[model samples]
Target: MTVRETAATSSSNYLTRAGRGRGGQGQAFRNCNVLFHILFTLKGVREVASGQLRVLQISEKGLRASSRRKDIPDQFYMCIGDRQIHIGCVIVSRKRGLLDIRFLNELPTPFVGAVAALEDPFALLEEIRPAVFGLDGFVN
Candidate 1:
């Protein structure tokens, strides 16, 4: 099987094991389910025609980290305020603690809730961050 398929299968197996371990323990199960979603959520511009690229916030570090991922698509874009910024991809820089953003287009002024507004999206990735992260009870 292909690497991607293998990875997907492994991830599924891990999730199944986790779910089984929680085993209908109401609250614990619920928390685990929520954690799974939060951990897998992706941050980036998905579609412009649908206004789906509107990002409210993201950590600079996260942006950099994401840029470095080889699997990231080439056409990623982040819409900030009135301008649209096209980024090639993001890479995480451990030392700088910031997202190494490479712009295919000029970096624009981030909107009031642009992803570029934050220094680290995951730093506040705990359950208390916001509904956007969706981990509410997972971190705690």
Candidate 2:
């Protein structure tokens, strides 16, 4: 896994899987673009306690988010930016209250922009909102 994670030693297959495919010499979606304060929701079989999560940063393929609940399921569904659509995610790493996620599919460019375009919900205080672990498979 370590070798696969390293760009130098990573195979072409690994690169493709990572969305860093042919002709794109640099890793695709490696850069974290959205640094704005964004809050999104997480739903894991009613694991939500108002299931609000804070977005630390997000990229086209993944995101770093923080949650109030300690027990976030390894897989869950979440909204992208202000969009109502649910996207699947799988936890890649967890530490303290932070969750590092990989989207099941590469997000549309527009969706990524919407998250970056959003204003800080907490600072605004009165403000606004937003997986791939298909909720359809989960029981209530």
What C-alpha lDDT do the candidate models reach, one value each? 0.29, 0.51
lDDT of model 1 at position 108: 27
| Residue pairs in collision within model 2 | 77-131, 78-131, 87-131, 87-132, 88-131, 88-132, 89-132
Most TM-score-accurate candidate: 2
Runs with alpha carbons beyond 4 Å of true place in candidate 2? 1-50, 80-83, 122-140
- The residue-by-residue lDDT of candidate 1 on 23-102, one tens digit each, is 22221100000100011124554433312221222232122232223333323344321222222322222243323333
Which ranges in model 1 have alpha carbons more than 4 Å from their true place?
1-63, 67-70, 73-99, 112-140
Candidate 1 matches the true fold with a TM-score of 0.21
Using all chains and alpha carbons, the TM-scores for the candidates as numbered come to 0.21, 0.51
Q: Give the TM-score of candidate 2.
A: 0.51
Q: How many clashing residue pairs, candidate 2?
A: 7
